[model samples]
Target: MKFSQWIGFTILAFCVYILWNIRQLLLLLFTAAIIANFLNHGVQLLQRIGMKRGSAVLSSILLSLIVLSGFFLIIIPPFAEQLPELFKLVSLGLDQLILTIKDFILRLDPELIKALPNSQQVVEQLEPLIQIIAGQGLSVFYTTLGIPLTLLLLFALTLMLLVNPSAYRQGFIRLFPSFYRKKIDHILTECDRSLQGKLTRILFKMVMITMLSFIGLSLLGMRLTLAQSMLAGILTFIPNIGPVLSLIPPVAIALLENPWKSLSVFVLYIIFYLVISIIESKFVAPLLIENRKSILPAVTLLAQVFFGISFGVLGFFLALPLALVAQVWLKEVLVKDILDQWKSNYNYSHQEFTSELKKK
Candidate 1:
């Protein structure tokens, strides 16, 4: 390559390296952006009803704070009190389950029992590996011991962004060449709309799941039903694997009391989740987000692994949102414009683009 070309390549590589080093900060900023977007919708709604921008933003922030405070006040105290009992129940449940399994094995033929490998020996061999993995995971979390500070920074940033979102949006647009600024602005608008729709759908699903789980657990007379349901609801944000993890605590506690009750709890969770899933797929999503493409489960899992490794637990949680945003940009800029229908000039006018975007 020519010397100028080599210099350009070197500059690009250096920029990438710098970005990689500060990726965590970027993720936090992205999170703030998502929060700002969610809040911005509320601001816009208030504006439509004749409220000024500042008042609208303030009202939205106050509303969010009120909801959060109410949730913590209602849920945290009881959950904290019951935590010890919950752990004790889990231990008893495991013991009872093991005994039941042993009794079943004893009824099997002597030769069949003899052929079975020793579970204790297998566990012993796996213990060190499990401990190592767990230690590494804990260490990663320890490295993020300042997460509260990070969260504070994020909240502050979101507030600042909310106060003058147009300034930031315009600043971002100004970063591009003058000719491409319109297209970039259009793309950003699309991304914001997509993220808004995704979050709305998720929040709706979470509320539904929490209510259904709570109702089901109450009917079954399960202890800690509120805490269990809330946990289930929050974890439902994680997609495919979340519902299974959510079932473990309640099912284990129930199993300690009655095997039949344990089975019923499991069935109840499955039915509730299945119903929610069907409604979400069939109705809720189509009504909420008609324009955005769904993120595939496999892609979501891959994003989780990548973000989890790169940014730890917080990253793992934000993986879906990050992936969703990335998918939007990739589809609009890379796939649609560059790959699928690359055209030179083609009389691309702002009005024509706006018309096309509206149709989309």
Candidate 2:
């Protein structure tokens, strides 16, 4: 193709290379920005209640810390204690499940059962996989020790952003061409509004859903209902895969206690998830994102996975907003102005051709 196109492609590739090299830093910055955006809402509310900006920020930070600490206190120890045992139990459960499957298959289809790998062999193969996951889990635990440092950085950045949001907005807008800056500004404002509303609704709904899940699981006599419920609720933020992963722990716990009881709990979880998901899709999402277009669910999920893979847990958490930002940029800037221009010109030419034919 054209030399200009080649140059553009090269530039794009170079930029991507640079981004990949500095992905960790970019992830940290994005994480800070997301936290700042959420906390900015609290700072604004506190300001409305007659607090100064600094005081509001400080209060919001402290409150966040308290909530986080309380959550850790309630959830972490039991999780730490039970998680290892849960893994061991799950391995045993899988072995038993495989054996049951093999027995049933042998009765129904002897050839098929013979073709399958032995249950004991399968279990042996899984041992290495389990060890790798356990190692990763330990890594995660150690990584968590850096959380206070991360939070401090986030708080400092957030305070700066809240103290003078306009400055940051203007700085970002200036990165674009002068002709596009105004449009970019509008897009940023719209994104901020959309995210604020969506996140608030999500947080509130998650809390209610978690509470209901906890109560339901508790009623069903599931162990660690509170912890599992909290996990299930938090995972809901990740979209499609989250609920499934969340259900696994409780279902396994139920199975360990009693097979029939686990089956009941599993069925209950499926029903509950279906109902809640329907309600969320039909009512909650629409209400939260009223008048604000969002990226497709598939795109959102892909972005989360991509970011999560590249940058780990923090990346996963910030993926949605980052994807939203990318979507807004594509739609408002690239699609509307650049791509639509070609379509508009083509339509105009077609109209002219039709007029000439009519005259002829």
Candidate 3:
């Protein structure tokens, strides 16, 4: 490589290194941006109904808070009270399951019975896995502790963005050379549309999944029905893996009843999610999101794995929106502009568009 090319490469590497170090803050900012984008959508809707911008933003925020507060009020106390009982039930269920398995093994072969680990031995074997789960629980505890302060910062940032989003939009455009600014602005619009569409669809899925899960579990006479259903609903926001994770708790509880009951619970979850997935892929998504295609399941899972490794839990939470944003920029800047070598109006009319936007 030429000396200048080598120098540019080093600079790019340094920039990436710096970004890696500041990834947490970047994730936080991006999260705030995503929230701001959704709130901005609400603001736009309110504006169309003849509300002022400030009132619209305030109304949107307040409406969200009211809904969240209502759920917390209704659910938190019951969930907390039932949690210990749920754990006890799971432990009892697991013990009975182990005993049953041991008896089955004994019937098969006396020697196999002797080889099979008893409950205490099995617990010892699971020590590491239990410790890992405990550590994760602690991490969740710490995250919960910090949520208030984090939400404060997030809300503040979101409010600032909502107040004058066009300024940020224009400023970002200015970072590019004047020739590419229009194209970049167009790209930003595409990102906005994509984010909005994904967010809308995700919210709808959450509601539907939660409702379906609750109804199904209730019909099956599952304990902690509310908790399981709400958890399933919330986790549905995490694509591909969320439904599987949501299955664990109810299945464990069912094991307390009997193996057949456990199997029934497992089968119920499978059928419920299959129905949800079919309906979503066939009708809901196509009806709701008009512009962009849904993220491929492989792509969503890959993003989750990559981001989870890179940034931990926060990464998993923000993975889909992050993937959507990355996809937009990648498609527009890399594939279209660079690889495809698309012709640009910069050859003839760059100033015309910039001036018109500036006047607006």
Cα lDDT of model 1 by residue, 57-151, tens digit: 99999999999899789988897787777778776877777677777888875566666656587789977755554444345334554657766
> Which of the numbered candidates is closest to the native, going by highest TM-score?
1
lDDT for model 1, please.
0.81
- Lowest summed lDDT window (length 10), candidate 3: 132-141
Count clashes in each candidate, considering only residues at least 3 apart in sequence or on different chains. Answer: 0, 0, 0
Give the distance in Å from residue 211's predicted Cα in candidate 1 to where it truly belongs: 1.8
Q: Note the Cα lDDT for every prediction shown.
A: 0.81, 0.74, 0.80
Q: How many backbone clashes does candidate 1 have?
A: 0
The reply for model 3, stretches above 4 Å from the true place, is 1-7, 87-147, 281-283, 342-360
Candidate 1 regions with alpha-carbon error over 4 angstroms: 94-148, 281-283, 341-360
Query: Of the candidates numbered 2 and 3, which has the greater TM-score value?
Result: 3
lDDT of candidate 2 vs native? 0.74
Model 2 segments beyond 4 Å from truth?
1-16, 100-148, 274-291, 343-360
Clashing pairs in 3: none
Tell me how many residue pairs clash in candidate 3: 0
Residue-by-residue lDDT tens digits, candidate 2, 1-360: 799999999998999999987666566666667678888888888999999988997898889889989978987788677667666766676656666677899889889976787867887997774555444333433554365766567667766776777789899999888998889888887778767766776676577668878888889877666667777788877766777777777766676667787788778877876777688777777665332675688988789767666666656766777777777778777898888775447788999999999999
TM-score of 1: 0.81
The TM-score obtained by model 3 is 0.78
